[model samples]
Target: MRAALKWVLWDVKDTLLKVRFSVGEQYCREAERIGLNLKPVEVNSAFRQTYKSYSSRYPNYGIAQGLNGHSWWTGVVQDTFSLCGVQDPALLQTVSHNLYHNFCNAQNWEVFDDSKKVLEACSSLGLKQGVVSNFDKRLEAILKSCDLLSHFSFLMTSEAAGVAKPSSLIFEQALHNCEVSATQVAHVGDHYINDYLASRSIGIHGFLLDRDNKYNQSGIVPKEHCLNSLEELPSRLQEQMD
Candidate 1:
């Protein structure tokens, strides 16, 4: 029999909140203003490539020893611009700063339609809720601004934990803070590795939210474990309990 779930841990980006603006489009627009012409497609490709390389090398480097959110994001932005062939140190700094700060504003993001409903449903079920994300300190303010802060009892960030998801350390910290064992917790998020598999690896139930139906073609997850929306979560959890 499955243990009764006492808490639900969540990932922020692409899970509960979706950024309203495109990062690549914003970057290209900023570049054009600075006399640097960049195509959104090319800039996005370069940014993804740079991000993948950094994530591979550092593997949760945001909270890795001695790195804070600003420094980590600055490095990512700088590398993104550099890869896009912007070699001027002054220009790189300017664009990176612009990109980083732009994300700090809540207006740039929107909560998913299903997010609030699911949170309400879970709350009605008497489940404690909290955030476990690879984000930085600014997350608290973002959540507050987005009206989501009240739903969560605690907000754990990469900056606070000094480690990102897919590492058991952050998940362990959440369990410790909630005073619950892994079996009593379940995590919901969009990422297959960082959110679902990572939590499941440590005995926490993991639900993969595939809102776009993109993972339907990927056979890595069982149909029962995959959800098309957060609206399905409460019922799914109830099924497990029964």
Candidate 2:
């Protein structure tokens, strides 16, 4: 005797979608041209580490009393480069941000093949769809730019929801907006802890999407059901409906 499914919330970023950046060694060549010994791997790693740390802390420092206003990703790029021994922090910061901006909204970011095909199938079958992300204000613009914003009925952002994931409030807000109860929803995200564990705590069914199967979140049942791609979701849901 299992529960029926009704609401479904999906994570953005690496779950249902992935974004591309810097074509044909653009930035690596540019960094060298600027007289900095930078490799694509170094820049990529630095940017990613910086983004993760700052995005995690953003809402905590954002707009609180006496908290100075700033962008987290900007700080991430700046601080990461500084740690790597860059002297001209401002110039490098500016260039890096421009590079990251170009990356974020570029025609490069896209929904995965598995996600798109499954979503189209699910939508055709009328699954309530919503999106939740631990992100800043640019979410709407990014989604719209990528032609993905309209597919969702609800979008919960860290900035907009006044909190990030692992906080049930944001998930609750998403539930309210989507008109779905926790018992009936499923959330999919790349991170095991935030996307899967948090949703599980909210009494919702959850999915941990591991494309490479590189990471696994503890305490989930039926690992086979924890998909490697969204392609399996439709058939999986059909199994449930059976």
Candidate 3:
């Protein structure tokens, strides 16, 4: 018989809450406010390119090797502006600060329509819930502002754990925090590697939330482990328990 899942750990951004604005749009708006002229699309393209390049070099490389969240994101913002032909150091700092603060506001984000129902169902089942995300410390404040703080018993960030996902350390920390063994926990998130494979590596059941059906073509996850929506979660777990 399979062990019953007692804890449902979650990844916050892109899983429960979606940012209302794209990084490029937010950056461009902040830049315009600071007297810089740039189109949203242009800023978006540059931001994507810069972010992709950074990720390619260091996957989920946040708050490690003496780099804190502010410094890490400041570098990203600087690189983004540099790619967009805005190379002024002081201006980059100002734009990055504005962009960072904008993200902390709950108005800048929206919870997925299916998220609350799933959380409520899981809660009614008496399952413990918490957030295990690769975000920074600001995630706690953001979750609180988004009205999601009450649903979670704990929030673990990359900054707090000193390691990001795809590393077993963070998942191990989550297991420790929940006071459960690996087999007694299940994690759900949007990313294939960071969410699914990472949790699975440490024996935690992992489910990928592929709401758009985009991952069907990639074959990164077995169809059984892929969920198209959070609404399916409670029933899926119940079926497993049965």
In order, the Cα lDDT scores of the candidates are: 0.86, 0.70, 0.86
Between candidates 1 and 2, the one scoring higher on lDDT is: 1
Q: List the residue pairs that clash in candidate 1.
A: none
lDDT of 2 by residue, 1-242 (tens): 66567666888888766666543244555456557776667767766777577556655436443232235555665676665567696667665666566555736676677766776777776677888887666777778887777678878887777677888888988888866567767777777778888888988777878788665355354575488778777776766555
lDDT of 1 at 47: 83
* Model 2 regions more than 4 Å off: 1-4, 21-37, 48-70, 214-220, 240-242
Better structure of 1 and 3 per TM-score: 3
For candidate 3, what is the TM-score? 0.90
Ranked candidates, highest lDDT first: 1, 3, 2
Off by over 4 Å in 1: 33-35, 62-65, 214-219, 240-242
Q: How would you encode candidate 3's per-residue C-alpha lDDT over 1-242 as one tens digit per residue?
A: 78888999999989999989877777887898889998888888888888788667654554445667777777788898998899888999998887777788888999999988899899998898999998877898898888888989999998888878889999998899999789889899999899999999889989999988988658867887889999889987786556
Model 1 / residue 90 / CA error / Å:
3.3
What is the C-alpha local distance difference test score of candidate 1? 0.86
- Note the clash tally of each candidate: 0, 0, 0
Cα RMSD, each candidate? 2.5, 3.8, 2.2
